[model samples]
Target: MAQHVERQRYWEAQQAARQAERLARKRARSIDWSAALRPVEPVPIRTETLIAALASGLIAALLLGDGVGPGLLIAAVPAVAAAYVAARAAGRRPRPWTLVWGVGSLALLVVPALRESAWPSTLAILAAIGLGALALFGSRTWPGVLLSPLGLLEAAPTGVRWAWQGVRARRTGNARNVWPVVKAAGVGIALLVVFGALFASADAAFADVLGGVVPDVSVSDGPVRVALFVLGVVVALAAARAAGAPLRWDRVTVAPGTPRSPVEWALPLVLLNLLFAGFIGVQLAVLFGGYGNVKERTGLLPAEYARQGFWQLLWATVLTLVVIALALRWAPRSGPRDRRLVRGVLGALCLLTLVVVASAVRRMDFYVHAFGLTRLRVSVVTMELWLGVVIVLIIAAGVFGARWLPRAVMASAGATVLALGLLSPDGMVAESNVGRYTEQGKIDLAYFQSLSADAVPALDRLPEPLRSCALRGINDDLADEGEVPWYGMSLGDRRAREILRERPVKASFETCAGLGTFRSRSEY
Candidate 1:
């Protein structure tokens, strides 16, 4: 009896030790990032890098040619990133991630230039660039992009320390000796203010004349603007550094589990699979019965028929992915049999989801074919296409977990964005609408009038009545071309200028919102 008791105690102690070890591992995996930011490294800044960074920022500011349009700001991303790369301490050949970032970042900047430099276009382009930068410089993945911001706190202190160290080293004086310089600056400021006020009081004409002076030549505002421009560039470069070279964060990988009953994940997945199959079967039936039957059965119009179930199917496709991922990550397995059953069920679900994806794509195509392609419609089409590719990849990964999957996906996404950039989506949209208008006499002049310069040449291909009004609208948009300097140039503006220069069409400038009008409506 004593022997048995001793053996039981030993087993219990062993289990306790295992539990403690697991807890220790968990604790080790999780870190208080806030605490470990100590002894942070100084931000690197070489003379060449500083010059490159400043030049890139200046180029961007200059490209703001029309005074800071979204296109110039966004397109500046790649230029800025290129500057960062030139400046980074590492002189080794660029990594794959960095190259992807470079391509994607530049593409993001050019997208706005290719399309209308609307606020939406600006936001989307910047977001894409930011994501690429985060992944490339920091985590090399989507989640890492999200966590990259937390790295700022560490960078902040280090940057300050580095700056302070530089000042201390350069000054060759006691730390407290800054008082003399501060006093001199304060006295100088007081003298300037006193003299300036007296001068203004003595001569009202002088003050009024100074106030009327152009900002470009204003003595008082020039120095301040220069200072502000320099400050802005510094901040931008600093942000790039923080994002690219952030301190490492703790990463925890879940441990593999022992064999267990299949009941945990099997039954639920089977039910889900059956539900997906039934849904897919219904979709197939509807697809086969034709749009007419769907229209009759659902009491929906042709337009409604095409639009119907799109959002639902999109959500379903996304949900299935999440479900499959969860099952793979957390599902209890009763060895190989349970694993196979789960994989088969998930695979079945994925295949069914592919049908849903197809249905969504078909609906989008029908809608675009009927309504003519808009930016939103084309974007959705692209999204659905990407989803289809993703589903196929997921299926393949399930069958065979290749280590190259993530890299392949990254490459494909980068390639797609680059291709889209080269293809010029705005130009394509214009081409599609013009073709549609050619076949059908119905053309929305106002909508066409609202399109960017890429559409102008396309609109020129239309018949006289449509062409006349459309050209008139475009001419009005470009009327202020003389006011904008060459530096603030845009593709749209350039194209419109070229066309106008070749054949100065006397377009009505009354109805169209000239490009300058957007400044009033700007959200920024």
Candidate 2:
């Protein structure tokens, strides 16, 4: 009986091994490639590649066309089409040639309009759009360039590579139940607090610390305040992380039945906007009137007077209320209609800006002269251009919006503007002008004063090296009058006298000889 039992066990073991082998073979053979490799969605043509093709085509058409007029329109179609094809082929990983074609096509789109009338403001708008496109193109390789850190924080969680890995690991036995995420959050919060405190403290202490002295009370308080703020933010972030909430980009998705209709969203935003308008109106009213009070008391620029202490608090309160109202309106419960209302409000706001600009210009003549404010006779021309660009972006947000024609036109417009800015006279203005001069002590006073009244203060505050040169120029004028005529004086004194001697070329004066011995003389 024992032998028979042992035999049965041995047979069972062999059968089990054979069955395992068969199962492995079956599993290998049953592998489905389509299921494994299928994309989540169909790949669309890349916007940049299309843009490039359109640009190139536009150029070719324009060059080859019979006349300037016909060539532009005929060229645009081929350019846009070529771009579309190239973009589709390039998809996620585009070729250099693809980009080249797209860029070339885009140049064609704007060359005709721009060549016809070289408008600066129009060109600026086109330039901004082109920059945006270029940034979008670069995003394929270096995604961070187009995205802010805040954008990354929001969008990174939805991405397939990093987020998917984490998700899959959790699903499988390889990872624990969200415990690692919590741990990471906790650790990140702790590190943030520590680093923030250290940075704030070090910055506050830098000058004193180098000299081995303690910072003042205010400086010492910086680290403590910064640490508290960082701690609060980290704690909030940790709490959110613990809740397993998905990161938000900008939009808040809502459940279908939640009162997400448009009117709910619109009302609050509308009210808030009106409140903002009222606040602005009141402030301007005060400004217009405040001048009277200050003028009566003391003669000063209109910029000098204000109820700063109380008015600031009042403005803050008003702004805070407006923000809260807007936020309440923006919540998901307000729905799609709310978005439309917000858009309308935005448009109205733009209109208000135009009105304000017009009023301000009317009040200030120098502003109109300096900015060339009324060539178009329309307020917010630049703003309108920006609005158009924003509209294009909105259209492109839809899946089908990333097309050849628009992208190409946009790209061409951009390249044309860029070329113009670099190669034209206006570009000279952009290049020559610096924002402001802050290195006061390094500049020469007399030289600076000679340039403009603005530089007088800066020149007066100059450091030793440049100040000496300035003082010498001043002293030279003074010394030239007192010098004796007997063979003159030293080289410095003679030079001073000569400088004093210099008159306008129109004022003819004769100088025969100087110095008692080996005298030298020059024309005056």
Candidate 3:
């Protein structure tokens, strides 16, 4: 009897192992990895696309080669125009809304010419252009928006290939037609040189005018300029090709996570909702009872209390978003009861998270009010506000379904960045700090000195010593900007130069040394 029992136990264990092996094989077979690995077909290069790309490249090389300035707008115009022409030539109707984004992108490039602040304007410009590219040539879906930058990277090699193909086509198939155009251009140049030299020699005033009007061509930076031109050509080719035949990123689908039972999904979210609700209750008490009550109860100053929780609250809000995304992915979708549970639990969490977002904003507001506004403070506030907008969109998605959520979120982000650029954050910060100085009779002169040319107008409004001290650094910078070319000129730099010329700072460093504190603590 003992031997028979042992045999039966061994057989049962072997059968269980075989069953587990079968299940693993089934799971492996279900995933079609080759579908993702399949190569996409290359887009055909067209004559119109090639010509527009080369023109755009030439424009970029000419205008943007000097440096970042108003030339950014000048360079972008041709590239955008090329994309538009390429789309039309391909017999495709370009989306009208994409034109709006394109206009917004061009408008954002104007920021660098308007504001001297590097970070905010640069960030806004890059974001706007990236979103605009995605809107024009990639998917409007969430995944597509997220992956659009990668598409640009992949297109880099394709651009090189496109250029090679154009060269090859000219060499083999169109070789007979190339020499006539080259010969004609050479003859025209020869004639112009013979007549122009005679005219210049014949008239001294004409020579001087010609010399002033034409730029002095130099070979000192030849390699650098050539490299920039090549880079511009490659980038233009990539963009034009993308516009002609956009990748179908919207069709790319990610499999859903393994579904959980209703009890398994709901319990943790319900508990999380309770936790969020409890924290919100504490926030309410602090809000209604005033900081004085908090000081009395907790023995902490308003700024101290506000500072201690602001960073933590910001992280918490960020983590809560990740949690919601994961929860939605793993949610049970078996029945009406499961759907109701998800809507209730997730909706409650979203509402509570909004309160948390509000609390974070309020905390930052309190901190900013106490310490005065800086660039970092202003940037953080803007980011927090945008995050709040994202949460609201998520809630809307929960109700109306999420098909439109991704594009809407992307659009909102682009709009928010454009708004930030338009607001001229550096000027706003300077204005706010100047107002604070008026009220409190305290100022951070060193901090003002570190600001860009955008702050010059606001700082000019100060009294004698404060005004001279704040303007001293900016004056020196403007003085060094002796002769900016038309393409490299910025509105902020021009305005700053004008302001300094009207009323220059006469104070030396030693004179304004001990006038104001730096207020380094205002950073956090």
Candidate 4:
């Protein structure tokens, strides 16, 4: 018993010693102050970068402000200030961020100005720059960059120049690495090329599209317009440079996943480029020739506009989808199930829509033959209603039924194959024809005369060219067939009932309220 007790005591003492030693080691590790904090490396801010950022903003302001050159300066100040603040934090007394911000702001301003200069456009450019700056400064790797004066470096464009500079600087003990700069420059150049191609191609296409409408309107021969356009492009390029600074390369960096596949990373960009070119480049050319608003003046039917928009949208969608595919390539890896789940839901919804459409087709035959209902309008309405119902089903399926639907789709693939084969071709052709017809008949200025006063308000609220169209529709109808001829009246008289008359302008809110308070218009 004595021996056993002694042995037990020895084991207990050993355990206590072991525990004590562990604790001591842990304490020692905790108290090791040298390992607690990382050494702070100082970074110097470049003066040239600061100047560039501000200069960019200034140029943007000038371009956006139109002939009112001061607008550019006004717009550039905020960016300059931002740059300065950033530089101060980088242990440098320079203001490159401000300079770049100014430049970016200027670039943004110029593009809009070259298109159509206005306060709203200026505001939009400024807003974009501000948001971009916020995003750059808010990032995890460089939140301190925002606080640092050199944060503007984070805003530099990605390209050959940036890469070369980074390389040169790093080699000469001026920068850390040239890789980022190179990456930025390369991306920027790629995007520029893409955009340029889109612009050039779209511009050419516009010549064909606008051939029947405004054939005579030509580009301005004056150097001013050309200069403006050049300025706009330069500003855009500068802005692109600035914009390239904050890309999460880790997130967007491509990796070889599942080997090479049919879909590629460049596909999305291709789609995006095509869509942008089609919509914007085409539209610009059309506008330059003064036919951009022709649809409104031509009294184009609503169906026509919808059709035209459809073709454009279809191309746009294709482009967008391709671009999305490419973008997804660089996106962070996700589960296969998660990725496919969305498509599955969409397929289910489409199936549901097919069911609904089938039901409608059955009803149509009964209504047409048995009920002796043969009116074109009624037939059209019936078909539309059923189609609409199917569409709703598809949308619902996509939104809510995606997860399990894919599995079901695979299970019922055999049945679906037959139905889809039959339905796909006819439906696609009909839809396409309808789309084309609609575009061909799209509304323009001639129909403006037919709209009622009630419709005028909505039309007036539309963007410039379109609003003018709605107005024409309303006035034309009034002149030809309305009971009252209220032509030559100021804008206020048309809206007089809703507007108060206390202020000089009846539509002024203060005047309206004041007149209403006094009960003058109502009493009269």
Candidates' C-alpha lDDT: 0.59, 0.37, 0.75, 0.38
| Span of ten consecutive residues with least summed lDDT in model 3 | 33-42
The TM-score-based order of candidates, best leading, equals: 3, 1, 2, 4
Best-performing candidate as measured by TM-score: 3
| Candidate 3, 1-524: lDDT as tens digits | 99999999999999999999999987775544324422344345655566656666666565555556787777666667666765666665757557666776777787887777788678877876687577556466766778766666766677668668866888788877766766886899799888877888999998877655443436886666677667777776767656665665555667899998888888998899999999999988884366687677669876687888877887887888899899989999988888888888988988998898898888877777788888888887788788889889998998999987877887788788878877888789889989998998767787876778888889889988789998887777767766565566678877888888888897767778877523343454
lDDT of 1 by residue, 1-524 (tens): 99999999999999999999999886765544333422244344433334444555555443452443343654355445634553365442456665666566555656555444353355445445454444434444334444544554444454345444545654665446655756886899799778876887799998766444312234655555465455445545554455434444323123555543577767888888788788777767765466687777778765577787777878888787778767776666647876687778778888888888888887776666677777677666676777777878877877787454554565555555555654556667778888888787555555555556666667677665456665665667767545544434456556767876776654344433342222222100
Expressed as tens digits, the lDDT of each residue in 308-355 for candidate 4 is: 443333333334334333443453335675445435433443443343
For TM-score, candidate 1 versus 4, the one ahead is 1
Model 1: how far is 458 from its true place, Å?
Answer: 1.4
Look at candidate 3 and tell me the lDDT of residue 381. 79
Query: Which is superior by lDDT, 1 or 3?
Result: 3
User: Which pairs of residues have clashing backbones in candidate 1?
Assistant: 65-488, 75-109
TM-score of predicted structure 1: 0.69
lDDT (Cα) of model 1: 0.59
Stretch of 10 with least lDDT, candidate 1: 515-524
Candidate 4's C-alpha runs over 4 A off are 1-75, 78-85, 88-102, 110-123, 126-256, 260-315, 318-524
Summed backbone clashes in each candidate are 2, 21, 0, 69
Q: What's the lDDT for candidate 4?
A: 0.38
TM-score for each prediction?
0.69, 0.27, 0.85, 0.23
Pairwise TM-score winner, candidates 2 and 3:
3
